[model samples]
Target: MDDTANDDLDVAAFTTAIEDFNRFYIRLPTLEKLPFTTLSVLDTLAYGDGPMRLTDLARTEQITQPGVTQLVTRLEREGLVERRPDPGDGRVVLVHITEAGRRICRSRHADRTGHLIPLVARLAPEERQAIAEALPALTRLAELGRDRGRAAR
Candidate 1:
């Protein structure tokens, strides 16, 4: 085939594969049970080194500042988070995850792993090997994207 035809085929194949992977991943029992936004916010807080500012949370979550505040309020009401004044800046309220939040996060992570492990085990050996070989590059791609996202904000 000509170079143009080859390029078009490559692009289509790449796009389809990404979409398929996302579809399969989001359909997993663990993810399907949680609201995407709640999981996103909880995951962010669980992974962060410390409390985050409301504005930063909004930016990270790609939502409005008020939206994040509202979400935080709801989380606080549910005992999943607590807001405290930043020692460095009394005016800045930092959102921190509560013990309940941490517990839920650990539970969710375990659930996802438990659900995925069986699926991975069921895959043919060759298919599992192929995925393991691709993992490093895929992980690198995710890291690059995360870096770019941080830089953008």
Candidate 2:
């Protein structure tokens, strides 16, 4: 195959790999408390990198601000997060996961991975290590694509 075609195949393969893995991720019973969409947003906010504006949260999720607001409102009621006036700009509030939020995130992530671990454990040890190593590369690949998307604008 030509180089370009091979590269396209690589992309397709990687996409398929992740989609397959995430299918397992989405199927975990730990997802019961929150839908995947809501869990995803919570995970993003829990990064502790810094507070993100509503618009930024929307952008991160590739969703609309109104959508993010509705999500935050729900999370807040669940005692998973709180909205606070932005330190940078009071008029623009940012979502901060509360202690409960942090606990839920930690617990849920653990539970989700617990579900995944048994499946991964079924693979041979070498295969498991290889999969573990590949995870970082896959994440970096995703970030690289996301960066390219921003630069394209």
Candidate 3:
């Protein structure tokens, strides 16, 4: 805990955790060869609870359908994903992670389970509550930032 910045916010802990996460994720050997766009699409699905339609995912990622299509194609070729027809709507295809994709998700997820979750778990009850309460506002800020950035671009 020496030299730990005890600023108004637990900025050091948060920033260190973020930096460590980025460092580990970027260093993963498999990721070295992955296209950022392709990995982003897979990450969107992995971060969520389930598969998504290309259009829906693309919208969430602020990318185009053709970009999603290309990423999906590459992932499919890599055996990391599969395209399935929506049961109720055959015209709409849902992109799902295959076993390999699940494996990748699990491995990548394991990396976070060690660092971020443990530190978060160490927070006092009230502190955790504060974070929970702040989540919505933070999310709104992030959304606004994204929207503004998009508009600016």
Candidate 4:
């Protein structure tokens, strides 16, 4: 195939693989333990620096400000999150994950790893090696997407 043809094929394959992964990843039985939305917010908070402003959380989750407030309220009531005054601005309150939230997030991560480890272990050595090698690129792809989101905002 010509260089252009090969490039087109590569793009098609990459896009399809990403689409399939996105569609199938959340459907894993281990991940279904909590409502996806709840887990999503928790995971976001877990990965963020300290407390996050409510507005920032809404933007990050692609939800309305009020919607995020409701979600945060629910999480807070569940003892998964807490509201704190942003030290820099008393008017600006930030949402932070509680210790319970950290524990839950860690448990969920471990569950996910446990689920995937056996599956990966079953793969051929070369296939497993390929996935291991792809990890850094996949992480970079995620970072690029996040950077694009910040730029858009």
Candidate 5:
């Protein structure tokens, strides 16, 4: 094959591998009580700069405004998140993750890491090293994907 054909094949293979990995990862069991959407909202709130408005959360999470509103209400009732009036805009309400929410997020992260460690350890030394070397590129890829998603929305 010509160089261009080889590169195209490599890109296709990489995309398929990433998609497969994501599918497998999503199927892994966890002790989480919250639905995936709720957990995702908490994760964003926990890691974000500060509280975010409902509209912002909806945009960032790629969900409908009504969906986000319902999720936030549930989270607030569970004491995982609280809404407060935005200081800059009285008409706007911002959602902030509570300490309980942060704890849940941390526990979920630990559980995921625990589940992955054994699988990663099963890899050959060279394969593990290759993954480690690819971390930066993978991170950049994730950032680009996130940016593209936002732009598309």
Candidate 6:
């Protein structure tokens, strides 16, 4: 095969592998009853440097403003998040993740990692080493996709 053909095949295989891995990962049991969207929102807040505006959250999550408002309301009710007047801008409200939210995020991460540990342990040493070496590239790929998504929005 020509170089172009070889490259195309490699890209196709890589994409399929990623998709299959995602499908398998999603099937793993989760500790929380919260929907994926809710967990995602909580994770964003928990991992962010600080609180964020509703509009910013909406943009970041690629959801309608009204949808984010509703989601925030539910999260607030559950004591996972709180709204505070922005210190710099009194007119704006910032959404902050509570300790409870952070705890849940930590627990969920641990739960998923726990599930993956045994699966990963089953891999051959060389296979595990390959995955370890690929981490940086995988992370960069994720970052590129996320950046592209934001730019497209």
Give the count of colliding residue pairs in each prediction. 0, 0, 0, 0, 0, 0
lDDT against the true structure, per candidate, is 0.82, 0.77, 0.74, 0.84, 0.86, 0.86
Best first by TM-score, ranked = 4, 5, 6, 2, 1, 3
Model 5 lDDT per residue over 23-107, tens place:
9886677778668899889988997556988988998888999999999999999999999999998998989999999999888
lDDT per residue, candidate 3, 1-56, as tens digits?
64455555686676697688678656655423556666666776776546888877
What is candidate 1's lDDT per residue for 2-118, written digit by digit as tens?
336765447566668989988876566763355778778887888854588888889889999888988899999989899999999999999999898888788877877888898
Estimate TM-scores for all models: 0.79, 0.79, 0.55, 0.86, 0.83, 0.82
Q: Global lDDT for candidate 6?
A: 0.86
Model 2 over residues 39-106: C-alpha lDDT tens digits? 77777778634566777778778888789889889988989888899887778887887888778789
Candidate 6 residue lDDT tens string, 14-126: 87999999898866787876787898899888875469889888988878999999999999999999999999999999999999999999988888899999999999999
**Mind giving the per-residue lDDT tens digits that candidate 4 earns over 33-58?**
77887888998889754588888888
Best by TM-score: 4
Give the distance in Å from residue 13's predicted Cα in candidate 6 to where it truly belongs: 2.8
State the local distance difference test value for candidate 1: 0.82
Model 3: weakest 10-residue lDDT segment is 25-34
Q: Between 2 and 6, whose lDDT is larger? A: 6
Better of 1 and 3 by TM-score: 1
Evaluated against the true structure, the overall lDDT of model 5 is: 0.86
Kindly report which residue pairs in candidate 3 clash with one another. Answer: none
Cα error, residue 14 of model 6, in Å, equals 2.5
Return model 5's CA RMSD, one decimal. Answer: 3.4
